[model samples]
Target: MSVFLAIVLLSLNVGRSGGAIKPVVTFTPNWGNILYLDDVTLTCDVPSTAPEEPRTYHWYKDKRPIPGDQQTLHIIESLGRDSGDYQCQTIGGDISDPVFLNVTERYVLLQRLPSLIYEGDPLTLRCHHHRFCKAINPKFYKDDQEIKPSGSDSTFHIPNITRSQSGRYKCTKQIQPCYTPNVQELSDESFISVKELFSPPEIKVPPSRVIEGDEMTVRCDTRLDPLRGGTKLHFAFYKDGWTVRGYDVSDTYRVPSSQLEDSGKYTCEVRTRSDTVRKRSDGLYIQIYELFSSPQIKVPPSRVIEGGEMMVRCDTRRDPLRGGTELHFAFYRDGRTVRGYDVSDTYRVPSSQLEDSGKYTCAVRMTSDTVRKMSDGIYIQIYELFSPLKIKVTPSRVIERDEMTVRCDTRLDPLRGGTELHFAFYRDGRTVRGYDVSDTYRVPSSQLENSGNYTCEVRTRSDTVRKRSDGLYIQIYELFSPPEIKVTPSRVIKGGEMTVRCDTRLDPLRGGTVLHFAFYRDGRTVRGYDVSDTYRVPSSQPEDSGNYTCEVRMRSDSVRKMSDELYIQIHELFSPPEIKVTPSRVIEGDEMTVRCDTRLDPLRGGTELHFAFCRDGRTVRGYNVSDTYRVPSSQLEDSGNYTCEVRTASDTVRKMSDGLYIQIHDYKMQNIIRLGISGFVLSAAVCFIYFHNKW
Candidate 1:
């Protein structure tokens, strides 16, 4: 940390040290600017509480490391080479800021002690010349104006220095023997700067925003040069320019329990123990917030209802910073205590009467009663149990197929929040919904007949305090027109695409209402209800020919309509193929032929047809113009089931014929010959075996 601090100070040229104390460099002869061959001593002053002991020191010139390990560096007969910026540091301490020294080889030179001058510091100036010359007389001049009378002494001093005393200064002297061959020796003018002893003090308050009853601490901040560390400083605090604390070594003032009235401008004064250097911080404004706001008497109901339960609440807000603080409340009536302090913020009356009306007030305070506040009185008026009832209808313009709700509106004291109220609805002076705990009557789907003058009555559970609302007239409008089925391409043909659309005219006022459509054929659902208004059949067949109808309705399935049935006939494009066999009874040498017989509709005569033949599920011939398969020679191996298939040239219409069985009869003479051969071979084998045994 010490090494880091030294590096930071040197790199940033920082004036104040934040960590370890920084060493201060002071010259023994004080004046840094001098004539050649002048002897001077530089000392490194470090503040410490430890006993004196051998300590290591480092020195630098012009930011470069130099050779110096002692606390003091003495320059014997300083020469021009000695002129440069000097800095020093000690082990485990911060490095000091650089101080510049100037050396000139002139006949005369003007210098000031304590190269760095500050307000309230003593200052000394010397009119110097070469040692070989003896000065006859010397005088000091500031800003080219004579400041000191001619005298034999070469030194001039000021008891205390101020900023106004800073300017260019030079000295004039008469030497007995001058190297320049001039009688009067004049020193070059040098600039002097007077710096402040300490920066201005600033008032600081942590957690700038403070709440009442919270501890607050105020601080005064200022910086004094380390070179002036020995100077003692005293601090004093003020509020609105009035002294709150007298001079003291401490720079902080604390308040144990802050209050709202304590909010004001605050400032602090810093001065040297000798009362020489004084500085006051600028005024800072501070505001103390209330721990909890003043209590206010609040009645839930605008008008208190007679014979009803009444509840009064003392409402107050606490500072968010002190959210967990507990508070006590009290209630007053006509300047008399109606309820003593309690943790609860409310005062309740089981049954309120007209006599309960009076001026009410509430008081609140913290648990310790360190701060207490009361609200201004409020006058409460009590009246009947309820306000006049009024009827309200949602969506005043009711539409068919829309849900409607009618409510009996009335105001009841909130104190009776749990009290059960019964409500009844009427239509055209006839009761629609009987009295119940509900205050509203709802209609799932309204029709034209439901449109009439509607009214409602509200009453307490015991039938007491009944109020009737004025009648409200409602008119239900048709939501949409009847829907009809629309088929594209008026005439539908087999093997062709067909589309059925449901058509309806929705009321403009009911635009954006979602409707679902469904398609049916022969009284059976062909398509389920969906948002689409059209249903499509990719390819129509004879089976698709039926009494078709479409349905349209609201998403709620309310007010549904079905289109009139329409007869749709799909003209056949082609008939299913059938298998035909020639020479049904097969003989051993008879030739057999199978054919796929199919008839195309006359209306589609231009459509080309292709056929294929299969024997027991195996293709005997691929699709071609020939639809017949022939067996040139009838044999038992060729006696199997055969099938035929036919399709249009585009392969859109395909059909297969039923299987047909064929049986081939083998010649009886051939079978008998095969049996005779087998018997002869067996007989020969037996004869051979007998002959071999005899031999």
Candidate 2:
């Protein structure tokens, strides 16, 4: 018994040892020190101490079981919500240590505005802590290079500023471990620009001369950065350093109307808004002159023969700058400078003609650094002794449809007697025709298709003279009259057919000839068959109701006589049906019916007929009828008056009644009543008279 108990205890011990599972969990994270707004994963794994079924795992936060029983924990975006301590626990009895997370913010702040310092002026830059209650000692940096360590209040001060002191400056807080050591929390960079103080503004172009009424401009510029409050600067112009009549402006001043009093030394000065700096330009001297005088012109022997040489001179008396002044002489014809001379005194005009007769002027110029002044112009004219030759044409005006002749004649030259001469005729500059005649030539009217100014030239042994005659205008007349047209069946039915004819008297010039005639309606030409004298327009439509005309054109070519318009109108036709009453004889108080029939196209639908009952000349009753009409009559009034009319697309017809009368017995009751009333009235009057006498 003891030996058997020992065996069972060994088996039990073995079973207990085998069923005890060794649970293992491995926590693997995607990252260490999880950052804000990042995803993190915590994976847990269990080592094999085999159980009969799969073991379940659960995740937890700060030792509390998560909602789902999952071994792997997934954190989507790590915010403050997911920033607390995180841990995972398994159903098989394993747990993980808590993992802590942290969040931080980064930003920048401004402590002061950018400033400008004049030369030798002190400057300062101030920066404050970016985050509250943080142990941060700000460090100063210039152009990203460490300059000095700053105290609790990050302020950088410069004792004196020069042009080299201008640069970008910033301050940053120092950070320690957990982040990079000395991590900069930068402050907004400030700019410091240095300027020079109270340098007199430079003046330019002194001793400048300008004529009165001419524009004069002077510029004053300084080397200062305008972007650093440039508009706040004030500029003043002074003549010899005393304030002149002008307002303060930037760099330049322009005096459009310069007077003689404006001649002086000018200077410009610029002042800054802070009163710490000012600049002035170099001095400029300007001289103003009076209005320039008009130039004088001189002509030698103003009177000269045509084709003879002449001399013309132009000179300017006033010279702005003395010493060998070179004057420019320009010759003009009709106000246009044709030739110019670069001479000190005079210019020669060669070979003068009537075309060379016009005003001439000359101008003198002085060479100066400040201004270039020109003297006023001088006027001169060249005269010549010659008269224009005269020309005439015979039969200047020509009438249409008549024969014409043209002759070219010039002034007779007596010096050259009976000499062989050459004559040429021109119409529009180009020679039309030429002939070797003594003096004149004749042109036929058939050759004068165009009319314009005609010119003729007669050549002698020594010279050739040409003259232009007055313009001759030629007129053409309209000799033919428009053709006349006529048509048949002037009126047309709305839907009925009709025909038309267009006729005209043929012209004698085109007699016995086959002429093509066309018909026109509206603005469009209508199609029709043509004859020598007339055209037939057939099968006309309603649209053909308008003015129609005929054209008598030559059949060989379309260009021929066209006729005037003829008016025509088409009318709508209405046809009524015929109605007849049945039974030649009728008695009183009987039913009678009339039938209406029309011989019109079936397509012309919805035609109405009017029926009336007339006695003698008066109508008793009237009504409209479609195909058939019925009437119940018993009296004589209904028997006498009865007529029916039918209307259709082309005609209207009225049917007369057979004039039947109904006979009836006459009654005497009405006459008996009238006689009895008259007898009673007489008896009453006799009785009244007797009673009155007895009383």
- lDDT (tens digit, per residue) of candidate 1 on 1-695: 12213222232322344455667676766676777888878877765443477789999989998998999898988899999999999877788878888888987787765345777766778888887777767888899899997988888888677778888888888776644666765555778888888889999997878988778899999987765554568999999888888999998999878888778999999998767668899999999898898778899777667666679999899998889999999998888888999999999977676667899999998898877889988998767566667888878778886799988887776666666788999999999999998888999888878999988987777664577788888877778776778887677767778888888888788899999999999999999999999989888878988988988888877788788888778766677788887787776777888888887777677788899988889998899988788888787778778888888787766788888877776878668988999999999999999999999
Clashing pairs in 1: none
- After TM-score superposition, what is the CA distance of residue 21 in candidate 2 from its true location, in Å? 96
Off by over 4 Å in 1: 1-26, 41-101, 130-166, 173-185, 196-198, 206-208, 221-234, 247-252, 272-275, 295-325, 330-340, 345-363, 368-370, 374-695
Best by TM-score: 1
- Candidate 1 displacement at residue 642 in angstroms: 99
After TM-score superposition, the amount by which residue 383's alpha carbon in candidate 1 deviates from its true location, in angstroms, is: 19
Local distance difference test scores for all models: 0.81, 0.52
Score candidate 1 by lDDT: 0.81
**Model number with the top lDDT:** 1
State residue 240's C-alpha deviation in candidate 2, in Å: 13
Segments of candidate 2 deviating more than 4 angstroms: 1-294, 300-306, 318-321, 331-337, 344-347, 357-361, 366-384, 393-454, 458-695
